[model samples]
Target: PADGRPIVELRGAGKSYGNVRALHGVDLQVFPSQVTCVLGDNGAGKSTLIKIISGLHQHSEGEFLVDGRPVRFTTPRQALDRGIATVYQDLATVPLMPVWRNFFLGSEMTRGPWPVRRLDIERMKKTADEELRAMGIILDDLEQPIGTLSGGQRQCVAIARAVYFGARVLILDEPTAALGVKQSGVVLKYIAAARDRGLGVIFITHNPHHAYMVGDHFSVLRLGTLELSAARSEIGLEELTNHMAGGAELAALKHELATVRGVDVEELPEEEDLTAPVPASSEGTS
Candidate 1:
């Protein structure tokens, strides 16, 4: 199933609103069975790029391609029709709704005549259980409200649902942002599982550790521009982390901080406890 062709691509992509340019000449290629990690800090044109891919906004310049052909999607539904599915941070499930109900919310199974249609509750519940189990998710009860599930569990459910509905491309936005250590690990496992199942996954996040764990390709964005792109083999965790923190810029800031505090870099204490109270300010002292 891995033909090595990109499922989607953006060449020289740019987006602008009024006189403000949010993105500039960004290029990305997403292939099946691979995870493409997009890393950027706040105001780094991340949201704008996501909008362009998910059809929430159109690019003002450059070519958007699906299966190596140029196309412009007028709406998110249009992209969805082409098997591009985006799983937002919020997960999009009704918290108060039962797991099975939320699983089939918009695309519910039905039985009986058209005018007298009724939900096929038994079938829906059984299918939801099977689908989730196939994704290695074992829920205590399918009848339980989705609100009762943990954040990682909810994210897994959303992923399983997207795959079940025939999504070939999965766009995940900050899937592990608010999760604890253990919960984040759980979600990362599922993300790898999704990629292994032959889905082209675009993982958007600022966490280098999380991205480095499962990424096959990396794209770093900064200040409305594409700063770097590399295959997994060309980069390491430390290098990726430094680039995200603005490499040289971070070093410059550290030097400035030490200078202002009148501390010789080589003579300073090796360990400064961040939890300790700040020393008194010497603003007016000689």
Candidate 2:
């Protein structure tokens, strides 16, 4: 049961891409001041699920709820209008533009009347700096291009921008996949900060460690189906890891790795390091 009420909820959601069933009968809930993590392997319908929640794609079945009311979003704009903002790993910022410009990219403030509209640079820069600082993002220079920042920094800026724009529910898609340990921690802290501000957050990632650190609720998907769902207290890290990797697919992978290394399964090396590194190709999602 939702102790209070969820800011966002999905009931029996499903999506299909032609002949391929991407997500099937998935139910999810997102509450304020908490992170709801959606974890899955590649092609396990993580992308499809996020798309449906963020209004990038319409579910073929089931209903989406916001603030306890059912709603249908035909486009991402509709979702944003409902105060649901999505920050994909590849955030839509122009790398060459200054951080201030990127922060106000599409929604720039303007002064003067017709035929004399000019950007309110001073106000925009001041607000951008203040907002970023409030979100625990300290930048050396607001004039610097966003590309100059690390992956975590850019992710922070995007999150801050979304919050500043009046987002009530924030959906992040694999935000920390490209960052190092320290950088990932920065993003996780800001995520907590967002939750503290009473915004519901949906954290989409393949990293269980990261999820466990910030998430209050967890949902695991495998082969386009929901494998497990529960509060953090209901499951431990080992159980979560096993659910994610100790499944049939991971058993097959273990057999393959042992065979290739010419070792028996019982003689296998430590399973801790066996977690596969997300390849560079997957970096495109970040």
Each candidate's TM vs. the true structure? 0.89, 0.89
Q: What lDDT tens digits, residue by residue, belong to model 2 across residues 16-53?
A: 88998888899998887788999998988999988887
Which portions of model 1 miss their true places by more than 4 Å? 251-286
For each candidate, what is the lDDT?
0.87, 0.87
Candidate 1 residue pairs in clash (backbone atoms < 3 Å): none
Which ranges in model 2 have alpha carbons more than 4 Å from their true place?
Answer: 1-3, 253-261, 269-286
Q: Evaluated with lDDT, which candidate comes out highest?
A: 1
Error of 2 at 151 (Å): 0.9
| Model 2 clash number | 1
The TM-score between candidate 1 and the true structure equals 0.89
